[model samples]
Target: MFHNSGKLLFFLGKADRLRITVWLFSLTVITIAVPLAFGNLYPTQAERDVMAQTLSNPALTAMVGPVNFETYTIGTMTAHEMVLLTALVVGLMNILFVNRHTRVEEEEGLLELVRSLPTGKGANMMAVFLHILFINLLLVLLISVGLGVLGIESMGWNGSMLYGMVLGGSGIFFAGITAISAQLADNARTSFGIAFAVLMIAYLVRAVGDVSAETLSWFSPLHLSSQAEVYGANHWWTILPLFGVGILLFAVAGYMASLRDLDAGLLRSRAGKTTASSFLGTPTGLALRLQRTGIISWGIAMLLLGASYGSILGDLETFFEGNEILQQMLAGESSASFTEQFLSLLIVVIALIATIPALMSMLKLYKEEKSHRVDLLYAHPLSRFQFFASHLSIAAVQGLVMFLLAFAGLWMAGVAVMTEPFSFLTIVGAGMAYYPALLVMVGVTVLLIGFFPEKSGWVWAYLLYAFIVLYFGGLFEFPEWMEYLSPFGYVPELPNEDMTWLPLILLSMVALVMVTIGFRGYKRRDLQG
Candidate 1:
């Protein structure tokens, strides 16, 4: 078992995308650093009290966990902000890692090739688990050391260690969950969907539970380690439950892996209808069919987020009133009610999330091409334009669907929760307002795939850059041009500011031109695969 695990680990290491891993790790560090930096910027006791009061807002608490006003220090503030977000980052990493090595390898036929070698039945599974465990260890070390070094005086080593364990332990828990999911679902996408659903459920439960009752938070792995209450009345016992649950999940995953055959999942794929519909033969139909599940997954997540944000609208005014700092900032921007401002800001964030599915749809084209599936399809007399256009169309349509559905969810919540009159047209308009920016994201992905197929994954970095620029640019005091690099920058914050048609028109034109260039490049270039 040791020898087999070692061999498999070497293979996994070789196949891993080191660049992306490093980027993601750096992102985790940056995310942690931002709040610490913000906290440090406001060292006054008065400022800390104000920030702590703001953090206690139900709306804010719903996003992260509740703040401890009793221990209202910079470290506590940093921990309150960083805990959930860092858990999310590490959770995503573990999910992607397990899925890629387990299900994705099986789907791509590499798992079979590895199995043909002198390896034990569970060698591959154990190796992935070991690799992830090692990664989490490194994550713990980095986070602990980084926090200690950056916040030695405020948070202390004990608090830092506890916080690091909270993040790394949650990641380990999710790694085990994803491992089980990989064995249960035949395809990588399905495995990811299942794992993501579990992650979301756990997170939502933690969020709701943390806001309502202290005991309710115990059920979620995300909130389990956070029970340590770093920098306050620290309870070291919380770490025990987290690691214990993680080990149990890992053991269960191994047992499940032993039960399943390679490439055969517990949830077996169903056979398609014997007679194909005529439209199924067309590229557009095929693209839509392939993207249907992905669309639904993204849509559901958007709806959940939108509804959560909407339900909290009743607290927006109260939240603003409690935090004079936020009110001052909003006052400087617009005369609109706090509710409208909150909605406007949140919709932009929703738009950012909506861009993800659109980008994935476009990136799907790259994956298809690299997998040589496109070559096979081209052999069957399909034009390059038709093949390309089909996927791009799916992305565009998916983006529109995501935005509209998200707005619908928010509108429904507003009607349910708010006494004030809510305008459906206003919500629809806000959703539509995001279309051009989303198209620009899709266009950028297409442009990358066409011109730099080998390096197309860099589009993720661009998206991350856009996220930082759009959300933190003002806080960080970035140059106007840097903010402009994000398509969302040009978008008018609708419902607060009157809609501007010119920017939308120009953004649409930019997307069109980008698509044209990308298509032309894809057409003229030699097939990569």
Candidate 2:
């Protein structure tokens, strides 16, 4: 059953080496950097205690798991603030990694080609398992050593090791979930949908459990990792359930894979209508239909995310009152309230996130083109301009709607929680100020899909870079020019700083030029498939 599994594992590693490296490096850097920063930010025990007390509110407990304020050292603060959030991100990474290798490869026919050779039936699945295991192991080693090397008083070697193990355990648990999802769904899209849905459910369960019911939190893998309590109690035993359940799920997936035929799944796709509606025949209608599920899902998620952030706004004044580090970050703005400054920061991050679905909407055209589906549409009278414009228009409009939903959610929730809420119009204006930056992102997507179709993935990489620079630049004291590298940097931080029209206008014009050039390239270039 495992014939040539070693060779297949090496092949898989070679194929994904770059992606794996980037994820590992990013996660490791963030994990280590946070503790180092915390040490400098809260040098005195008094500041740490104040921060801990401020974070003790129920809103934050729901967002990040409960804090261990008993000790309240740098390590404890790091664990309180970073562990649950980092675990959530690591779970996402594992889900995407597993789904990409398993279902995505199968959809692209790469697995079929492999099977035509002398490989055993179970060789490919075994290779996938080993690949994921290797990646998780490397992550564990990197984070543990990285933290230990920092030599912080509270973050000792043993506690660092426990922290890394918790992260690795959460990742493996999600990888197992995605593996099972791959076996159950026939296509990559359905497989990804199922896996992500499970991830969301886990997070919501954990959030609810943390706020109200301690026993219920035990059901969530995220909560299990939090239970480890690294740098505090350092409950090493809490990690057992994660690994145990993860391996069990992997075994169940392998067995299911062995029983099923190639290119098929346990859950069958439902049959479509025999006769299509007239609207489905048009380019705009077709694009909307293809992307409807993703748009709706992203919209709801953004709304909920905004609400989560909103829940904590009422406590920001207390959270930021005596924190020297945060005050330094916002030193330029003495006139604005701390909550407003924090709101500006939150809007930037949220806008960056809202860009994902917008970009995906446009990139779907490239995906379809690669699959040769676009060739059929071209066989009819549809013009390149019409097809391109349809997707571009949908992306632009959806981006705006997503931003609004998030802002609306934030405003509604903030009003409910705050004794004296800020103006609704102020929040709306602040959010709308970032819309031009969002357009620039959509324009960049168009530029990529138009000319460098094969390298469309670069947009995501650029987005990641933009996020790091825009979100962390101030905190890290990066050079001024670094902020200009991202579109979000050009726009004024709203409600805190007065709105300026020149930069926003310039951004919009830049987007217009990029879109125009992209359309021209699309018209000239040959179709991919």
Candidate 3:
């Protein structure tokens, strides 16, 4: 069943080396950087305790995970603050990584070519499993060794290994989930949807369980990973369930794969209507139909994300009232309230989240082109510009709607929780201030799709860079010039700093130029599959 698996593994590694490197490097850097900063940020045990206490509220527990600090050391703080979020990220990485290799390859007909050779029936999957295992192991080694090298007294080598193991276990667990999802869904999109839905459900369940009931958390892989309590009790036993369940799931996925035929799923796809609706006749309508499921999913996610952040807003004033470290990190000026300063930060985050769907919408054009779907459309009455406009327009409109839904969710939840709620219009205006920045991202995606469709993936890299620089710049005290690298940095931190129109206008102009150039490129370029 595993014949030639080594060759397939090497092939996959070669294809995905860059992505694997980025994930491992980013996760390790973040894991190590936090602890390194924590030692200096909260130098004394007293300060660490206060920081832990400030973060112990139900809202934060729901947002990150339950704080498991007994002595409130730097190690405990790092574990509490970083583990759950990082695990969630690692889980997502595994889901995408697995789905891309398994279901996506099958959908694109690559797996079929490999199978025509003398490879075993299960060779491809076995290779994927080995590839994922290798990546997770590398992640574990990098994070563990990186933290140990930091030489933080509280973050000892023993705890560092456990911390890295927790994340590695989480990644393997989610990789198994995606493996099963790949066997269950015929299409790459549906396969990814199923895997991501599971990821989101795990996070939501863990959040609810941590804030409400400890017993419920035991069911969530995310919660189970956090139970490792790396620097606290060093509950080494908690990691067993993650590895065990993951292996079980992998076995189940393998069995399912053996029983099914190539390019087919255990779960059947729904049959479409024999006759087309009038709405599907036009480019805009066709684009909407193709993207509606993703758009709806992103919209719901944005709303919930905004509400989650808003739920914690009521506690921010008290949380930041006396913590000099937090105050200095979040404070903008002497006059800005802590809540306002935090809102400014939150808006940057919300805007960035909103940008994803917008970017996805624009990138759909490239996906269609790569799949040769655009070729068929061009045979009809559709022009390249019309096809391009359809996706771009949807992206633009959906981006605005995302902001509105997110801000609306934020306002509704915030009003219920705060003693003195902020004005709805104020929050909306503050959020909308970042809309132009979102357009800048959309423009970049459009530019990539027009001129460099094969390299469309680079847009996501740029977005990730923008997120890190803009979101963590203040926390890391990144240089001021670094902020200007992303459009989000151009906008004033509204409601904390005075709103500036010049930056917004400039961002809009930049977006316009990119879109215009992308349109011209799309019109002139020969179609490639």
Candidate 4:
């Protein structure tokens, strides 16, 4: 009966055309390629020694899985960097892909139409599974070919194939997780949150395990990708559990689907209040309420990340003591403390990640309008300025609060780990250093909304562009002007470099101008919705 169902290929075609899918896939490939290319560029003993020491750090290992320092070849170097990050990228892909096809379709009233045709009850789920499977398989093939072309001897053909398979396995595992989350949540957004939260927890588990050198890492499916030991032990058995868990979760999703009515979830949603509160009547309050879920999610993640970085600070001195090479790499021939320099850079990274929420909040204006919800809000006494200002303010305020929490995490961890006195002032300054860049990102998103409401989704592409530029530009030796385009490029590197207020103040002014122009432009244009 299922053989005639064309839903599988149909959805695959649909996914193939989506800009989101295409960009994500391309980013994953770039993530792998960039690291591989860099690893091969410097094969000298000094460079390898530096790489070995960097990978040996507890914090770096906690973030990225422990590297096989004994086998720090280009292949292993590539694997060490790519494993954790690529798994995350591919996992997000599956989560988004699955949610779009399943819960999102049901929400948009398209699932009913699909079902009304001569299709089976399981057609949608089956189609989604097939779609995810194809994506992973294609990713595996791409990575294998890319690695082979790079000619990394340590990760020979077999090791490269295993590496690719491990990545694909992680995606497959998360595809099941998101499938189950979709069944449990009443809406697509809620499903994404549920799955994302689970992903974060899994990541933290692996981080804690890697840092403490414990067995907790084995419990996370995310850890499974790294445990495969692609170039080292080459354990093929590690891949079995991914398939096993995926099949079990798919079966459970199908059973759960059978129990629920179409467009409804297995979990019951809470009913809303009968009367709106006085504060809820205000636009700013309304915006805050709308964005609270995302704020909370990003906030917790940031705190966890910050704390992770902090916990390792106390060990930095010890880790650097024996190795003159690592000490020089971390701190140049300067009078400044090594810990401060590392902490400053780490805080900057946290603040950069905090941009994710800032941009999301700014783009919320476009989202509401695109979904036609803004019209309903505007039906009341809400002015355009109120609508725009409220959301942007929330984003700004939330970014500030998120940065503080991150700094607080660092401070708390520092106090816990350090026997000597820790300076809260330095940490606070580092966190605040990112404010200009954060504001600039929000401003850019607003500009996108104001000028291109119909194509406002393109703001995400801008975010990706900025992220890559700020984080990887130096590694890739990108042109200076191109890197300058990222707001982060203007932000001072903090304690590593002297705190310069000129660029910070100038960037702030630019952000202010951008916001003003966006606000004016949005007022003049007809509502896209």
RMSD for each model, in Å, please? 2.4, 1.8, 1.3, 3.1
Of candidates 4 and 3, the better by TM-score: 3
Q: What value does the lDDT take at residue 432 in candidate 3? A: 97
lDDT of 1 by residue, 88-155 (tens): 87788889888988888888888888878888777887898788877887777777787788744667
lDDT of 3 at 467: 85
Worst 10 residues of 4 by lDDT: 322-331
| Backbone clash count for every predicted candidate, in the order shown | 0, 0, 0, 0
lDDT ranking of the models: 3, 2, 1, 4
Please list all clashing residue pairs in model 1, or write none if there are none.
Answer: none
Arranged by TM-score, best first: 3, 2, 1, 4
TM-score of each: 0.92, 0.96, 0.98, 0.89
Worst 10 residues of 2 by lDDT: 325-334
lDDT of 3 by residue, 1-529 (tens): 8899999999999999999988888888777778777777789998888887878889878977877667989888888888889999999999989999998888878899999999998888889989998999899999999988887788899999999899999999999999999999998888888899999999999999998898888778888766888877888887888888887888899899999999999999889999889989899999999888888888999999889888888867778876766675664554888998888888888999899889988888888888777788989987887888899899999999999999999998899899998999999999999999999888888788788888888888888888888776766778889879888888988789887899999999999999999889888888876
Which model scores highest in TM-score?
Answer: 3
Candidate 4 C-alpha RMSD relative to the actual structure: 3.1
What C-alpha lDDT do the candidate models reach, one value each? 0.79, 0.86, 0.87, 0.77
C-alpha lDDT (0 to 100) for residue 89 of candidate 2: 86
Worst-scoring 10-residue span by lDDT in model 1:
323-332
Report the C-alpha displacement of residue 501, candidate 2, in angstroms: 1.6
The best candidate in terms of lDDT? 3
Report the alpha-carbon TM-score of model 4 versus the true structure.
0.89
Give candidate 4 misplaced runs (Cα > 4 Å): 1-12, 15-57, 67-70, 112-120, 211-213, 317-337, 419-422
Candidate 2 scores a C-alpha RMSD against the true structure in Å of 1.8
